[model samples]
Target: MDLYKIDKQNMEKIIGSNFDLERGLQNLIENNLELTLGLEFVASEFTVGKYRLDTVAYDRDLNSFVIIEYKKSSKYSVIDQGFAYLNTLLNHKVDFTLRFNESFPEQKKVEDFEWGQVKIIYIAGSFTSYQMDAINNPALPIELFEARKYKNGYMTLNQIMKTSIPARFSHTHNQHKREVADKGINIDNASELTAPTEEQLLETSSENIRDLYQSMKDSLLEWDSSFEIKPTKLYIGFRLNHRNVVDFLPQKNALKVWMNLSKGELNDPEKLTRDVSHTGHWGNGDYELKIKNDEQLEYILSLLKQSWQQHRIEH
Candidate 1:
């Protein structure tokens, strides 16, 4: 995409600047991890065994760890390095867990995190075609992002989305499997490695509640294509720009919704939302509402829209 500056009603092409050092890029991303990637900054230059990771971030929504690597040049193999980092994280779970506990005031057990949802993210000015192809498989827990810094202190970070869906590897090579096995890595099926499926999450609700949840979900998606549905162990979250805008937890008779807004941030005229800021809750934010039927679906959607708009503006 071309960027331009309007100078006296004329267009001036804005040139992008290259990052002089990898450290600068790392610092920029680490400081703005939450705004850019919706992740909590954990540690920088975190060393595990022989490898020194660029940035170690935690995903609060997924309850997982994200390993980020910044590169000034696209000379490395993303697949090999990504898997190696994953292997390191899985092998040294205790070290990572201890690091998290030490970094934050709240202490959590190692089993509290969703280890299977752990993923690697590579950020560079550009990526090679081969590197892009390496992560074409949907089953791969790897993401590529291109970060560009332009003049006038403007910067843009965009994910390099895969163009094609490649077939998954049917079986691992005997030698490769043996090598990973020796390193104490179990190559489990991809299905078992992620969070609960949407279908499974909805199974907890009755047929009417499921239908109501689906209706709200479809409306949310229709409002914005960028919104994504992320199903965790407790609830299904509707995310905008990787941040949770709203969370839906379907009950046997009712569907619970939580908006990702603070106490005073949301503008509720009808007083439809319950303030859960002082109360302990499983969802993301302070506002919580229950939907037993679709009679007030429109009003509920309006409430959710407030959260979506607030999040977008704040971020």
Candidate 2:
């Protein structure tokens, strides 16, 4: 509180003593509007007609806008402020829907924004019992942690920031960990196939499946560019997103799904469940097709595409 201290050398300690992190953030954003929006400086205090927001972070990637509010908590709670900020942001954007395809015709597309899809996170040094409760039941995006100075008394908060508001463990990360958890069969396994024709053989037997897999995969992408692969024993199945498809198989946690190739085509493989047991990774993850004969690859390729569709219909 001393206003007479004019020593520049002791300024850091003084500033640290009065760091006021929340205010520092606010001031930083106000001074350099670009910092807040992560884009060019817009306005000190952006007023969308009538509402005034602390900072507006816009991303052209998804054509989205995020309203950020900084807080310095002397007490323990700042949940109310977060909710208020969310309210203001949503109110101002009564008609503000994300329209990205209009900008990037080939990159990505987003439909709409629901309150549930949006998030409001409260950042503070220490969260209170009340604040935690606020973020609990309805899944509010409130996160709290003490901000400390680097050896230099300057630290940023993005290190521990959640991937998404109300951040949950990413499904992709969970899938990988699940694969790692399973004891892998230590047999050296690799297979490749070339060309979309010819019973699509070339398994652990030939090195051609690689070309065939890539050719088919590339062709599949022409249908849906976002399609990705999740490998199994004989082949990898293409899907929009692994997370959604994996959800279809309730008990299967591992990504590498093992189906009976010798059992027959997709229709009769259900009966071949005898020799076919999951590699413990029945879910979606990267994998190599372990086919011995080209016929197996053809069966696998056909069943791989058919299995998912059938599962969808059956479900």
Candidate 3:
């Protein structure tokens, strides 16, 4: 894609530039990892056994570790390298936990992390067609991102989405095709990494609360095709443009909604939102609201729309 700048009602094309060094790309991403990818930076050049990972990041929402590898070349096999890193982490979970604990003030046990949600991301200026096709499977935990730098001091990083491949394909197809078995690595056993489903999260909710949550979910999904429902251990997150715009936690009697906006960013004339900026919370953002019924569902949706707009702009 091409980028353009408008000046005096005239459009000027922004020339793209190449990253002279892979370290330059790594530094750029690591410094702004939170803003660019919504992940917390852990360690750089992390070494595990024989492998020296470029960047180690933690996903707070998923409670998982994300291994990022930056590439300036298109010769390596992403599938092989991604699985290798995954294997390394799986075999040495304790080391990673120690790193996490040492890097941050907050501490967590090894079991506290969701190992199944662990993934590897490949960032490069471009990827080969063969590499793109390899990650077309929906079940693959690997992601490919293309980072383009412009001469106008601007850069755009975008994920290379998979094609319309059927999700029903055998999950072991890629592993077998890539012959990862030679190294005694098994990618088929993903049962341990499975995350809680939406149905499972709503199992403890009362009938009224379940209905309210369903209504809100259906409305948000229908409102925007880009919205995604990601059910975590604590709540069901509504994501827009890869960022959480809102989250819903269903209780026994009511549905709690957390808007992904800052303390004063929300414009609520009715003053229905509670400011949780200073309080410890499970969900993202500083605004929280509890809804037992749909009496003010429309107004709540409007408030959520403001968050959606803000996330869209910021992202």
Candidate 4:
């Protein structure tokens, strides 16, 4: 995509600049980890055995550690390096848990974290078609982000989407299965490794709660076609252009929602949303709302729209 500056009906192309890999892009992302990826920074250059991880971040939504590698050059293989890091993390889960505990003293127990949801993220200015193809598996918990910096101090970060390919190959050689040495990844084991699906989460909810969640889901989709519904073990996330706007935690009687807006940015005229900036919550954002009926559904959605628009503007 091309960026341009328009003045008096004349447009000027904005040239992009590149900086030193580690000193430039990597540091920039590390400093802005929370804003860019909704992840908490753990430790940089984290070493386990002989391998050194570029950046270690905590995914609060999934309660897992995410391994991130930044590449200024496109000469490396995503499959080999990504899986290698994942294997290292799987082997040294305790170290990661301890690191998180030390970095943020709020989390108390090792058992509270989700070790199975450990994912790998590779970020670069751009990726080659071959590199993109190397980690395009749907079941694989790997993500690729492309970062672009413009001359006008504007930057863009986009996740390279995976191609829709049918699973015809055997699981023995699949990337998801190959991550584990002998016991290949299967449906039974996948429950422990990956996030739960919308079906799985809604299955435990009562009839009325399920209906209420369905109504909210429909409204969320209708609000923006680009919004995606991502279900984790604890909650269902709604995002637009890779930025999470809201998350839903379904209960037997009510649905708990957390908006991505900041502490006081939410404009809740009805005072329905609670300020959770200081409180420890399962979802993102400082604002939370509990919905149980259809009467306030429209009003709640309006509040959610404010959050969605605020995130859109910030990104």
Best by TM-score: 1
Superposition-based RMSD of candidate 4 using all C-alpha atoms, in angstroms: 4.5
After superposition on all CA atoms, what RMSD does each candidate show versus the true structure? 4.2, 19.7, 4.4, 4.5
lDDT of 3 at 255: 84
lDDT per residue as tens, model 3, 240-289? 76578899988888888899988789999999999999998888899999
| Clash count (model 2, backbone only) | 13
Whichever of 2 and 3 has more lDDT, that candidate is 3
Write down the worst ten-residue block by lDDT for model 4: 180-189
Model 4 lDDT per residue over 1-315, tens place: 567889999999887654556457878889999888878899999999569999999876667889989888889978777766776677677788788889996965767877666788988888899988866766677899988898657888888888766354344234444454334334444434544557667777899999998887888778777786777777888976556789999987889999998877888888999999999987889999988878888889899889878877776
- For model 1, state the Cα shift of residue 174 in Å: 19
Over 8-91, each residue of candidate 1 has an lDDT whose tens digit, in order, gives: 989988877668888999999999998899899989999998799999999988899999999998899887788778888877
Cα error, residue 196 of model 3, in Å, equals 4.2
Off-target runs (Cα >4 Å) in candidate 3 are 5-17, 163-189, 196-215, 218-229, 240-243, 250-254, 261-281, 286-295, 309-315
For model 3, give the RMSD to the true fold: 4.4
Clashes of each: 0, 13, 1, 0
Instruction: State in Å the error of residue 46, model 4.
Output: 1.2
